[model samples]
Target: MSWSDRRHLLRVLVPGLLAASLSGCGFQPMLAPGSPGAALSGRVLVDAPTDRAAFDLVDRLEQRLGRAETPAYRLSYSINLREQGLGVTPEGATTRYNLDGSITYALREIGGDAIVASGRVESFTSWSATGSTLSTLGAEEDARQRLMQILADQIVTRLLAAAP
Candidate 1:
């Protein structure tokens, strides 16, 4: 076969062969219908947010695992966040900060005491503080939002994997 023709054939055949192999190995998409992830979607109730960080985390969780109309599981969580100054000016001012956060969460049946899934997820984000007061505040808030989203995604992944 011509070089161009061989390359074109390989492009099509490779993907087809990969798909065939994946199916043979019993590989399934996590969010596909009837999968463990689908079973948890829209059936988990996240605890109410008590602060800005908690609010952001809960919001992302609900976005991923749809808000439950009739909750079968209650998700309770505690958030711990710490900020440490990273970059310091020659004089005494801080120019940058690192925000470290961790969350301990548990998923339990609404009417039962047994914990179905529980774990702690930790993540960090940084922001520059060498700007105007307003700009620094904005950067800090954005970092916090990003951190919460990351933590929430980790939680959802764990919950999906733990789903029966």
Candidate 2:
């Protein structure tokens, strides 16, 4: 067959083959309205946040997974945070810092002793400390919130990927 002919043949045939394979495998979109993972919405109760970073993390998770009206599952999480000086001035003053955050989470069916899923997620954000003290404090708080959002999103993505 000519190159053009083979190109045309593949364009027509590949999609049909993919459709046939997928149709037989019972594939369904995880986050779709009626899919299995959709049932998680409004059904997971996140443990109460103990601090500001935890509060931000729970807020983002609830934004993604929906708040529990009548919880069928429990999400328990613990957060660890560290501040590391990133850049130092020639005079030995810290000019930049990184806020590193990690969260360990577990999901379990309500009233059950077994864990359905569990893992840890880590992220970091940097802030410049060269500015005024108030400005630097604001930047650090913003970085902390951003890190929480990132980690929470990662946890939700993992949950959706593993949802059946």
User: For this target, which candidate reaches the highest TM-score against the unseen true structure?
Assistant: 1
**TM-scores across all candidates?**
0.95, 0.82
Relative to the unseen true structure, what is the C-alpha lDDT of residue 152 in candidate 2, on a scale of 0 to 100? 96
Task: Name the top lDDT candidate.
Answer: 1
Tens digits of lDDT, candidate 1, 1-164:
89999999999999999999999999998878988888788899999999999999999999999999889999999999999999998998999999999999999999997899999999999999988999999999999999999999999999999996
lDDT tens string, model 2, 120-164?
A: 989899999999999999999999999999999999988877664
Candidate 1 collision pairs? none
Candidate 1 stretches with Cα past 4 Å from truth are none
Alpha-carbon shift of residue 128 in model 2 (angstroms): 0.7
Q: Residue 22 in model 1: shift from native, Å?
A: 1.1
C-alpha local distance difference test of each model = 0.96, 0.91
Enumerate residue pairs that collide in model 2.
none
